[model samples]
Target: MRRGYWLILVATILLVTGYHLRFQAPATITAEQGTANLGNWDFTHQGPVSLSGDWLFFPGQLHTPASFLQTLQTTGGAGRAPQTLPVPATWNKLYRHQSSHPLAQGRGYGTYALKLTGTGHSSLGLVQQPACTSSRSYFFPASAPSSQPVSTLGHVAATAPQSLPHQQPVFSALRTRPGAPHYLLVQVANFDHRLGGLCRAVYLGTQQQLFDLQLQRLIGQGLTIAIIFSMTIYAFAIYFYTPHNRSSLWLGLWALCATLYFWTRANFWEQAFGTGGTFGFAFHYTVEYCSLLLMGPFIIYFHHHAYRTRYVAERLLRGNFAAVLLLCLAVLVTPVEWFTRYYTPLMWLMLAQLLLAGYILLRALHDRQKNAVRLGISALPLFFTIPVDLFANLNGKPSGSYTELAMVFFVFMQGLVQGRRLGLVIVRSQHLSDSLAEEVKHQTASLEEKNYELLIARTALEEANRDLKALSITDGLTGAYNRLYFDRQFLIEWQRARRERCPLSLVLVDIDHFKALNDNHGHLAGDQGLKAIVSHLHAIFRRASDVVCRYGGEEFVVLLPNTSPDQAAAAAEELRALVASTPLHYHDQEIYYTVSIGVGGLPAPGPSQQPLDLLSAADRALYQVKRDGRNGVGVADVIAADIRA
Candidate 1:
């Protein structure tokens, strides 16, 4: 997939570059010794032609068309003739030996003159793009005696203050008359830039052709600006939504800088705001310099955020940011001439940043970081174009809009890389989602099985706990609740009865002559008799709230909630009769047992009445029953008074 994308990107770049080259104006005619003879040339058929050959140069002099014509007519083009220098070149590139006139050293006044000889009268248009620091051109017809120029761009003068620099594209129209030689003169002055004179080519064509060409260039520039600006918006949106990815922020900033810088280059500001005064010029240059200076830092920052790097790249990034910030400040405050002088150093700084970017990218690739290869591939065009543009600027050559095209290409490649990343993320997410669903289904079945096992274990544990509790509270021999159970349950019953204002009853039963029986019939007989008595007692007093406990050896007690003392005594008598009737058959002999019963109750227990008082009253009644006669029942009311006694 990656290789295919790379091939497509390479093919697209090649096709676009070829298309651009194919449309570029070709120079077919060359002038020698300040004259271009196009007697047989057809302007309509060949399209616009670049006036690229040698033109007569007069150094240290700014001349009008009339004065220059006068000088040529009087001098007869003999001694003291103007030295010939190539057009579409800066004065700094002039060789000392090539001209008898003193060189401007890229900072002086000069006049350029060209003579043209064409066949018939035709309407001609001169399209001058951004070429020099300041210049004015004139076209004079030799057929008329008047030396007045038919077209002019700006008020070009020898002094710096009088010269009005027109940086925007200029289109001047003129009509050629038959049987006349035409003169084209341009006066140029440079005091604010590193390289001066005509630095860009001038094209001459039919009026309609020139307008169409200018329109094409403007449309191209507008489209480039719009595309880059859209990328800026996209990057900013990403950054705003996901703040953790700082690369998006830096990319947005870099794209914004590129947009502004290119807008300035396309001279959109002059068109929008009109040809400005001193403040306007200063503002324009300041924005241009600041935008250009920030581009390097922003891109470096973007790279640093896009990939992790060693300390070297981080330090370089910070240093580049600080340097660019300072340069931007200088551009804001300083004059155009002062800041423009450092253009070379600024270019060098940008070059260093590009190298740093390459280093970081290579390291990322070596470490096998994500998107490293994509990013490196996308950066190729920018890397190639920037250095070429820098070289052209340094050598004072016209470095057209190749950098802009390269930037657009780079952005397109980056978009593709980002799109691929998003697609992979979506695919991986879908796979993971499916896997997660399957895992959840399997885990849910396993959990249900484990829960069923746990339910069974819990049921068994509950049964065992109930059995243990029963054993803890029950007497082994009599199968009745033990004294410990009675001690705890009596208080709870008393409290509940007191709160509900109900009667609480206790019945005490003692087996008569138990020791005598044990002595006569042995301990086995005694145990069997006790069990028989307890069974009869439970059968007689069988209520949900009734409690039966073996108080001690041969003694049993029964507690009944919501029962009166009389009712409890009746129940106790019934239990005694039942005990007498029921006997245990041990060793084929029947063992009979009789129990003396006592009843104690509180119809409405007082606040001061304690649970132990009822037990004491019951004990007293039991003693009374034993003293009177065995197997009989007795009752004791006033439990609290008895406890006090």
Candidate 2:
């Protein structure tokens, strides 16, 4: 019975060893595997291991897993000595020292072979594709048939990944028997003309860990999409409210471009368009190229509006648009080879745009435009990311969507800046409105005061005008009615007397030898004498029916409305006697003066008699008085029927 138990135990040990050999892989399959130590790694404690060691590189060759296995069976993959290249390093740079190599800096198919040792549940992943076109990765048991595939990872998509929002890397799951060897083969035959090489480290881990990692990536991508979509809608809404605000429009466009780019690079379009058609591939790359081109205008105009560079901003924005559009059109119409050949140079254009944007932002900050300071500060992340992305692209590495992440922050900060600026503008507008209202109030009060002053001036002017009219009809020297007043009165009195059949008489008085008095006593004494004579005339012609005026120099005329020639002659004699008796005080001397007087009358009404007829008759009588003797009165014996003065 003990012998039987020993046999059973040996059988059990043999079965257990056989099962372990059939399912689990060895810890070290070769010298290269020992260096990687995949079996020794603790899957639960550690992250994915880097397959960043030396790889046997074959250039200008297209080999599938079957073909590679067949070749390996024939010669153990040693027919031609393979070139050595480091994973996670650019193949272009690796061959840069070997200028004679046909694949050096020249785009073509390349196969990379490496050995990995891990348990049956291991998974393999090429975390990044330098250029995502016509690339494939495979993992299989080294001893397995060439026709069978352990696992296969196809190219993520034929989409360009220069811009943000690209698909996640493809990870392959593989199983190997215990103590058995396995191999990893990565084949890249990109038609895209770009620097060819591994940009990121390859990762090897358990299937569960890879699943968890992919789920995490999926979550990250989803969040990126949601953030970009929400921002796009928000910016578009802002643009709708302020249709003239170019910044909001550009921001919306920027977000939209980012979303489209992400869709293609992330292989979301693959599910819709599938990865087979040329159109899908072209469309994917075209979206990427267009998005890259759009970056310039969006960034430029955003700051243009934020900085208030309205004068030159629109022109620059249109120019940027035209340039980007033309370039995108070229990218679309150009052949694949042409695009690939110029892809790096095209990427360099982004550098130019970045530099230009930096200059514009810096200039805006320097000019002290409102919000420019904040916008510039917000762009610091983008500025840092630009050079990093540029270097990464040139070296064929994965930069992810760092620029897009920076843009998200930039957009948020810009929104805050715009909101703040709007609030300030509203405050300023209210203040200005209040100030204008106060100014209007002051102006209205001033205008009312001016109107009151004008009314007062108008009243004073009317009173002065009346006084001026009186002065115009009065003599300046004698304070008596002028000749013009006498002429007017003479006509009225003459006509009235004719209608009444009453007598109208005219009495004329002259200062005797007034010229001699003026020449001897001076004009001052003469003026005083004239004034004294006028005063006596006023006393003599006290009746309301009489009119008195200074007819000429040193002469006076008095019209008596209802008096005869006899009565007028008596009045003239009285005026002559009064003037001869009166004395005029001139300066310090009292000067005595004498006068001659004449009287005439219109005895009855006659149509042929005029006002001048009485004056001429009176003048003739006055000459008689002056000829006869000084200081006397004379009456006309007859009035002239027709006389002209």
**lDDT for each candidate structure:** 0.76, 0.66
Give, for candidate 1, the lowest lDDT window spanning 10 residues: 437-446
> On a 0 to 100 scale, what is the lDDT of residue 431 in model 2?
62
Choose the strongest candidate by lDDT: 1
What are the TM-scores, per candidate, against the unseen true structure? 0.63, 0.55
> Alpha-carbon error at 124 in model 2, in Å?
7.6
Q: Could you give candidate 1's per-residue lDDT for residues 27-83 as a string of tens digits? A: 546779999886777887877788878998887887787788777776675666668
* Model 1 residue 519 lDDT score: 96
Off by over 4 Å in 2: 1-35, 63-81, 97-100, 118-132, 150-171, 197-201, 271-276, 310-317, 421-645
- What would the per-residue lDDT of candidate 2 be over residues 52-95, giving only the tens digit for each residue? 76776666665666776666556545665456676666667777
How badly does each model clash, as a count of residue pairs? 0, 8
lDDT of 2 at 259: 78
